[model samples]
Target chain A: MQAPVLGVKALFFDVFGTLVDWRTSVARESEKILGALGFDLDWLAFADAWRGEYQPGMEEVRSGRLPFSKLDVLHRANLVRMAPRFGLENLSDEVLDDLTLVWHRLDAWTEVPGALTRLKTQFRIAPVSNGNISLMVDLARRNGLPWDAILGAEIAGDYKPKRQVYLAACAAFDLEPRQCMMVAAHSSDLAAAAACGLRTGHIARPNENGPGKGEASPSVPVDVAGSDLADLAGKLGV
Target chain B: MQAPVLGVKALFFDVFGTLVDWRTSVARESEKILGALGFDLDWLAFADAWRGEYQPGMEEVRSGRLPFSKLDVLHRANLVRMAPRFGLENLSDEVLDDLTLVWHRLDAWTEVPGALTRLKTQFRIAPVSNGNISLMVDLARRNGLPWDAILGAEIAGDYKPKRQVYLAACAAFDLEPRQCMMVAAHSSDLAAAAACGLRTGHIARPNENGPGKGEASPSVPVDVAGSDLADLAGKLGV
Candidate 1:
């Protein structure tokens, strides 16, 4: 383990691909909700399509082309748009709603729960994801992720990579940017957080998008980098 | 125990004097911080003086005479205002700041942690407090309060008793007002929440102001009422 940074009083995490394996988890959950409906297709591909719409949806709000909406609201709209291609358009709103909520039920990567529990002992931990407050709450409740508060896009009334999300999160905890650390698997998230004057910790999620398709290390400079959240916790001497 | 309210998916609690004994706890913490500095006076009276300024401070924000400020900021202002009356106006800013933060170190009532823990198993739990997110986070950390998210005045951009505060809390969770319950020891808080269409649960803190002073029963009609948080949890079958 490398030396830990001092003055880091809070740790803000990127939820989707950093703490949880959204691809596999969403794929499994979508299948459960859709398989019984006799609409079977490439479940992994389905999950990818669902996530693939995330950026564009957030861009609509980030760019001010559309008013800000909760991540689930956008997900529902995107689901309705993409369902026809997979022969799922005929489904009722009830089933489609169930499918949209899969984001709330994403399973944490194997070490996430234990790692977060340990990390929390030394610092205030929260998700600074693009996910909305309710979405974040559901994920924490379902996965045993102990967050000191729910804060992110919804609280900031904007999407991530935007400066408000990171800054608002730090201010919400009554800490200066230097006292908060952004922990994520993606180089992009760390870079944005660093731009806002926050320290950054990178957690390797090599299989986040499937084998060899995710970040094994941060592409940008960070205060700390490690193999996983548990490794990050160990590196910080948690 | 009375029958539990059906469809109550979330519980929003009023903090200070409700979940925790703010008066006594703040008095003790204030003495610990101030006594060593050679300031000897009536600590309980000191606590009352500090609390006495709270509503007036919040009124400044509620009336739009001042922009919304976190409870801590207003507390600091109130602290500085009251310092002269206590013959301690010469205190340094650092000392005054510490004095203002005693609100964060308050102790929970004896049955709060256990009851809250049990209720959490059946419903989503959070503090819809006038205290800002950081203040609530500090209190939760110092005590054993398990909150799913910190919500309330800060999130709503206004003080409680405002319609927006109650409505915004429900909207944040993607829940209808009817599906959420406002639990507090004050009838005024409950009445306001009920006016916003939320169910109400009352927890009696008969000694909140002082023994035999606080209402052992609510003055306004409530969906449910009990002796304390634990009894409310039991009434709800938690």
Candidate 2:
């Protein structure tokens, strides 16, 4: 692989499974909250099941089958659908709401805070995730990630893999798509952003979805690829 | 007056006058930049004239006379329109562009940082100004405002005092209007938010418009009124 030259002005990140370790965080929180109520099953699988609904739920909006609803609302409906499968039923509405918000409390990958702080000194940084504004805000506050703004599905009124989400985030910064880099662990996200003319930087998150469920590298070519955000920042000369 | 009981969960601020001293900052920057370039005029009046175009510019979009453009674009157009009067006509595009970005560097009012840091412990805080996302982000970064997200005209695709802009910001937080307090130095801003059912907190910015041109207090009733952010935070028991 040759060293790539890029002129990126801002970096837009995919939050879930990219900057944050959502899988483990969700599993841990599920066990802590649900275990307290004596509803103990395969917590990790429960977490996976909850996350499995994410894409299909988004597809409903992307396909225009439903008007855009925020990720929190979708998460709640997903949680209800998966609740009975895990011996959890009839939970109070408040408790169910708290469990769904586990996504908002996900812990960041170890190097994210330091790397992002370094990146911010050189380039504008924001999360262009599918998560809604309140969820993104909660996650940023909980983890100390210094984002310039929250940009994503909520503001775009559409989910990614959809081109409007990528284009809208760039428009928010008044930058051409080519001037912004999309950083993510998932190649598909980078691919979607790249398709919209954003530069793509890939970060390896081998443990993003438990041990064996995550990809260790980008499955496709990107402008830059590195082991993590710190490495990516170094690669970009930040 | 008896202390007003409030159950506010979030505080949405009007950034330009309420939190930051934009009039002074813009005038100072204009004088420094344009003075260096050998143009002379009443710099403060130049700043006022520039801002004076803001509401009317927004009204163009609010009335559907023009499609929604970000505040930065509108500011640029307004700057160009006022340039000849200030002996700034025929400046290079780069210089004009840089001048328009003066809004990004506005200094926060003296009590903002400390008061907001204290208030953050109790509520979700954000700027619900008409400034676009990029402008708000740059201003927040320059002034050390710990905003959870940037929300306003750009995100809402319409400027305030439009009801949709206020309602959109509240919706971003999944908050009821009554649960969010709109904080501002301008009565009309508060009045607009209040009409949308939001609670209001008035901050006195006596020098907001380069002295005497600005109001020192809300012209209408509000749930809370204070001398500055620190006073407001104290009044709110933060």
The whole-model lDDT of each prediction reads 0.91, 0.89
Query: Residue pairs in steric clash, candidate 1?
Result: none
Q: Write the per-residue lDDT of candidate 1 for residues A1-238, one digit (tens) a residue.
A: 2444798999999999999889999999999988987878899999988888889889999999999999999999989888888887688989978988999998888899999999999999999999989999999998999899998999999999999999999999999999999999999999999999999999998888888999998999999998999888998889
Chain A TM-scores, all candidates? 0.97, 0.96
For residue A64, give model 1's deviation from the true position in Å.
0.5
- Residue A9 lDDT in candidate 1: 93
Best by lDDT: 1
**DockQ of all models, two decimals each:** 0.91, 0.80
Cα lDDT of model 1 by residue, B107-212, tens digit: 8999998898899999999999999998999888888888999999999999999999999999999999999999999999999999999999999999987778
Q: Which 10-residue window in model 1 chain B sums to the lowest lDDT?
A: B1-10
**lDDT, residue B83, candidate 2:** 80
Alpha carbon deviation, residue B205, candidate 2 (Å):
1.1
TM-score, candidate number 2:
0.94
